[model samples]
Target: MSEDVLSQGEIDALLSAISSGEMDADELKEQKQEERKVRDYDFKRALRFSKDQIRGLTRIHENFARLLTSFFAGQLRSFSEVSVASVDQVPYEEFVRSMPQRTVLNIFSVEPLEGRIMYEVNPNIAYAILDRTLGGEGKSSNKVDSLTEIESRIMSRLFEKAFESLEEAWGSLVEIDLTLEEFEVNPQFIQMVSPNETVVIVSLNAQIGETSGMMNICIPHMVLEPIISKLSVHYWMQKEKTKSSPEDAEHLSKSLNNVDVEAKVLLGESGVSIEEFLKLNQEDVIMLNQSIEEPLVMHINNEPKFYVQPGKQKRHMAVQILGETRGEEE
Candidate 1:
């Protein structure tokens, strides 16, 4: 064997050459294409969400804005105005299709392959917000000016805040990320509803009057599915919580103990003339002279409780207790 050893660079070159054979250029290309296809399909399908989910998410944003407005009401020379810009639908693939224009400039799209709710920001609105947040330190006040680095950073922070507000208000159930996508002015976006596709578009714009720009919130349809399902489940749960079966609604009664009390029983034989009762009004007594062996009716809590006879409990009034009182036969 030769005592001479291969140089590090030569050995590296040899290893590279050997590995290159295992990955054919054409086969690698095909594999990459397959992966892209799978990813694209997933993106398209994952872009949808239900209507209730959109409302829930919007509520989150509203609550977040309210908190911010309250916190910085004084130092905040600027305030944001929010609005729903557009709601529309497109084929999942069509929405994600790449455009062929713009030769020199790179027009790469960051949109997911699924259909999306495209949100736009009024640059001026963003500037106003950013100026108040990141503005005090040598920031431009130009309404039409594109976002500066500081402005972008401030906007990023605000967006993150908005996302968090959404989660907190909605119970941390969804994940959301912002992406810049290629937008086209499509007439379909203006229609009131899209039932065929079952796509819901919700746009929330936050604008500062000082700056003419705004922030756009685009929620895809897929993000709302869980919310919708959850709402339905909640509604059903509420109904179930209040529901009761006939057997479960049956009422039972418990017997009450007897209490002795004396009552004067007026039998049919005891009679007083109307003339005699009227003539002897003051200090006159109409008495029912009955036998001492007669049982007297007893009352408890102002109701007829039972039948009992007079008895002695030292000096207190008492009665011989009878069986349970009849309560209209159940």
Candidate 2:
């Protein structure tokens, strides 16, 4: 009150008190800057998935989400749409703590990958499915605390089917077998990842007929470390581009038209010893397993391609294709 202009230190102290409510303004500012700063870049606490990896996983799981809806529609004969909600990286402990007290957590491993991953479905979704499967209306009002023995069994089947769909959806990227390791209701007891370890979470929101719920897939960075290269956009794009184009197919057909193919006709096969072969000198008959009525097998490039019968085509020893082998893929 006596001085017109206070000293710089006096002014700063008064300003800090007004700005920080008795705390040092500079200290408050510095504390705010300490949160998740990139400069802090702790190697032990790095992101589970990079931005690119998260984008790739988003693209991959979007397909899975769409397929999941269709699968539910077919099985439950109901309308539904499961959409990818978000892909994020968070500390594993944060995720575990966010889970409800009563939740069904499925721990599984990818056969082609090294470590385990987890799948968590909301209880509302589980109950809705249980009701639908048990011939009741597929709707829920209150959240379930725990699944009964019968309910758990039913949910296990549902989880199996969902994982089958997941396996099929992941087939193009990596042929993985999702085998369940264990199931738990108490998340505190489940320690799939260390408390501070980072994990990648892919969330899918489901609108199954009348019920709406969420599902999460948690994969620790360690599990994805080995095949992280496969999670890049370039790899997926190259795989798509490597498929035969129309021009490529035409060129292949034209080139094959000019090349010579070694074709052979086989009646059948019969087990004959080496001694029996030595005994046969000239014009010795070897009994065949296939009868005369049975069609001969046409061997193209040493592979049995088709069943054919010996016939005359324009005065040539040609054979007609009767049919193809059953259960053979093209």
Candidate 3:
């Protein structure tokens, strides 16, 4: 609003010029209009996603961060963390230039969508994961280098499993099947899109154990162009409102039923001192804490849940359920 108002000096100068017959008021208005600045827009680096769409991408990737964190924690068998650092739209060439000489670049395709997406892992993070997977302390080397054949295979399998998390994260907005298409170490080798093409980079800060590094997911505008309209707050909110049917719940229950769980029947316990245990022979007998009449405890996934009677059924050792145990108590 202040830009539209003229300062006292400017107003006085304008009035003086108008009264001097050197400048006509109507002509001055035309001159002012002609002097208006035009904002420069580069088509090469055009902003394909609006602020709302960017926020939507941020939300989608934030969910991906949580899923990836859980997946890595289980797969790496170590402490893992992932979080969305930033989301920015830039030219594809700039993204390539920003990448290191040697790093993990996984180009994957989203089925039912046209173009591919680049999932890049920084060298530090990649080596750390490789180190941890190979039974190291999850420490990365000071110098970055290309992965060996075996290392590439390991990483490919690891990230392929990670795609499940990505798919789940985007499940709300779209149903996509992500498949790894190619793995490359050099960014220069990547030419899936034009250098001037617009891409949205979702930077994720990932930490595996003590090692931390950046992981980026580069999505070109052409890939998202098909579903660009769905990347909006309104669309996302609408998707959130969709409710699952009873059949879906039934299907989920059926899936859970198929999952395997460890169940073991605990036998009677007996204690022995260190020296006594060391000197004990194979056939040596120790007095049991529980009598044969007492029912044994059955643990499901390490949690005591049922009491059972140990016996032989059809020449096979088995346990017959007596009753449910009251938690840890008898």
Candidate 4:
């Protein structure tokens, strides 16, 4: 076929026009809109946790209560009454102090640091609960005006326990042992930040016999990113393991190799009355009367292997390989 060719000048003119913004206006607008969408892309924020992770956290919380309950068995009416309101992913510096007019107690906050998760613990009631549950650890109290030191110790221990649980649940996926710094009456205006740039908030709402309030534990997002990723990977691995198990994989390969082979076996005889048999004591032959020449039924892994006449293998019962059957009788 003869080629339809363009001259060098023609190609040069076309290139010059394209470089000089000669494209159709509508096409340019469409392309620009697509690019703009990509630039403006931002995922909506929400709370999420794997079932195992959530369960781990919940068990930790329960254990925390148990420890406290054992510490103050009769002092407090109920020592374990905190509920996790939410575990959310949030932007740094977004949390602010509660409104000045709002007389809220037990507000807590935390900011990420280079090697620590700093916590801001506030209010008297929350600290009181912590103190009662934590008990005294060789440190005597003198009824001080502020429980700053006591609150710090209690919160530090609680967060440390939580970190330990996280580490145990996720193994190397989560790095624990970061310092847990705590304070009392820290103003919300002061910013606590993390080097990792992201963190998780486990907000606990304390419902103590009608006196309700909330507290928070902020954990670095970087500390949990690896955990979340590993959870996803572990889930997929479990699914694959289940799919590729020895029995299941063998069955699948067998199905692919021979579609005509059936894996089920059928009983030749149905249920009959056992009481109808003659009741003879010694040397009585209550025979089944099955033919010796009949091929013996064989099974493999609880499925039919083959049917063959009974044979002897060094005085042990054995079977000879016969034609593969699916309990079909002609």
Candidate 5:
């Protein structure tokens, strides 16, 4: 290179910065120091799960929810619906804070998956289950009572049953034998993970007949980090494909194809209070918010999937496709 050149504009900008103290020696040193400074990290809280992993966890626990629903129904000999309410990554302390102070906390470990996991049963539901077991009509109580020998036996039985369902739910992803290592009533004494460590909190709503309560499972991020790759969407889809034979897959497709789904066209919607709704007659008309020219909503499986126009198809009524909803994407 013959010579390096600095344009007049660049020179003027540098001179201006120097005069304004932006490029002063102390300022330059401060800038470098700031650039080199490391971020302050709190040891008490950290998150590790990504959105996709959270979605996968939600899907996994949804299966667990259905299993628990049926399990509780059979055990209670009554109607029971257990649903996974939410799956979230939270600090271990936050998870503990949301749990009942006097509820039973069963800490367990599974072979092939390292570290302890926590399972909590709300006292209300636990009491209801125990009440039903003792031939008493199922009842819920907020009172937290110490478990005597007989109650402990009942709890042990319930814990075993829960573990069996959990293991089965996890079987499609990984086969592991869960063993209960410790059980405690007060959560303050329990340490599933460090206070700052992030854990996945799987919250569940359990309904026993008319009574209802909540349950939760705390899984530390460290425990899942080893098998993190298996928690991705593509990995799960691949796993499902590998589990099915060609004939079985064909059978599944055919069965699904034969299944009937609710398909209806929405005219429009109008909201009414209880008093206004009770006063209405069949012939009385309620104006809808949607315009007449707007495409009607086509719903399948109770979800809006398409917008279409009302039309005639020979002798039958038909709908012309307008567009699909955001949720209808491939």
Candidate 6:
């Protein structure tokens, strides 16, 4: 605390400056007040996530963007692109106020987590998706104020299917089962979190064909608080490293063992003039270049793998593996 106490020389210099009119007394008082104001903190707008956590959120959502791009491309049967625009933290009330009056607000719950999150789509993109799904040239109906019963069901089903991609994207960070709980057009009607609750907003820019708009995801701090530590670059890196364990390799080998592969034995190769081939009669004999004792090459998935001898087993013809095929012969 010695640094906090003023020295005699410093006190004398301050008094001399004040007496000489070098510094105004009122100005000094106001400067101290301004410094105090600068130090004031607002709990309502608290930052719950660190920079590393925000970067992890960005990386996760970037992957979600890619998955959404492919999903929309296939579902709409049009060119689609999705990319991360920004990730920010703000009060829940501010996020709600920033939304347009009429938009697609999907409230979904992540199972094994306590609270719900919002997936909001801009009116333009939502209408574009609806128009495309209904067999029109992908276009947005800007004047849409409400969804009809049919339209609501269609969109609900469409987004529910799209959530599969969301599930897959978050699988690396956490296993979540997303169930669409509610759908609303008016933001005022929904209050999943407190007004001043801290929430992270992930904005995504999406274009389906010629229509493009923003998609925002609102996740409250309370919802993420439980697993907040997992939302870090270090955790993601560790998770990725764990995926390559011996158990995973064994599981992969077992999965591959069940896969079917085509294997065909090449009997021989013979060439003849087109005219001679066309003029050939029934029971016509064309001698092949391969000799009887020569082993036939066996091709697996169209690549020569081994040499085998042709023979019959019971009622079916089969080939006896002789040895591996020489690369030079191939």
Query: Which ten residues in a row are the worst by lDDT in model 3?
Result: 141-150
- TM-score of each model, in listed order: 0.35, 0.61, 0.66, 0.41, 0.60, 0.66
lDDT digits (tens) for residues 272-299 of candidate 5: 8999989999899898987987778888
Better of 1 and 5 by TM-score: 5
List candidate 4 segments past 4 Å from native.
Answer: 1-115, 118-155, 168-191, 194-274, 277-280, 287-291, 323-330
lDDT tens digits, residues 1-330, model 4? 233578999879867876888866578669756765323433333345565665555544455444433433344535445556665555444444331212112222222213334333334334454555565322223232454665556655654543443334333333444443443344453355532244556666654433445656555554455445454555546645764579888899988887554433332443335664445568754455455557756655566657776668998866567787666632
Candidate 2 wrong stretches, greater than 4 Å? 1-45, 141-146, 243-330
What's model 4's lDDT at 262? 42
The local lDDT score (0 to 100) that residue 55 gets in candidate 5 is: 88
Give the alpha carbon lDDT tens digit for every residue of 96-194 in model 3.
999988888899999888899999999899889989999999998834464568888998888888878989998877899999999888899889899
Candidate 2, position 209, lDDT: 69
> What ranking emerges by lDDT with the best candidate at the front?
3, 6, 5, 2, 4, 1
Better of 2 and 6 by lDDT: 6
RMSD of each: 23.7, 20.0, 13.1, 14.1, 13.5, 10.3
Full-model lDDT for every candidate: 0.46, 0.81, 0.90, 0.49, 0.83, 0.89
Candidate 5 whole-model C-alpha lDDT, 0 to 1: 0.83
C-alpha lDDT (0 to 100) for residue 30 of candidate 5 = 92
Error of 5 at 305 (Å): 37
Off by over 4 Å in 5: 1-44, 240-330
Instruction: Tally clashes: model 5.
Output: 1
Rate residue 301 of model 1 by lDDT.
45
Which stretches of model 3 miss by more than 4 angstroms?
1-31, 142-146, 241-330
What is candidate 6's TM-score against the reference?
A: 0.66
Clashes of 6: 0
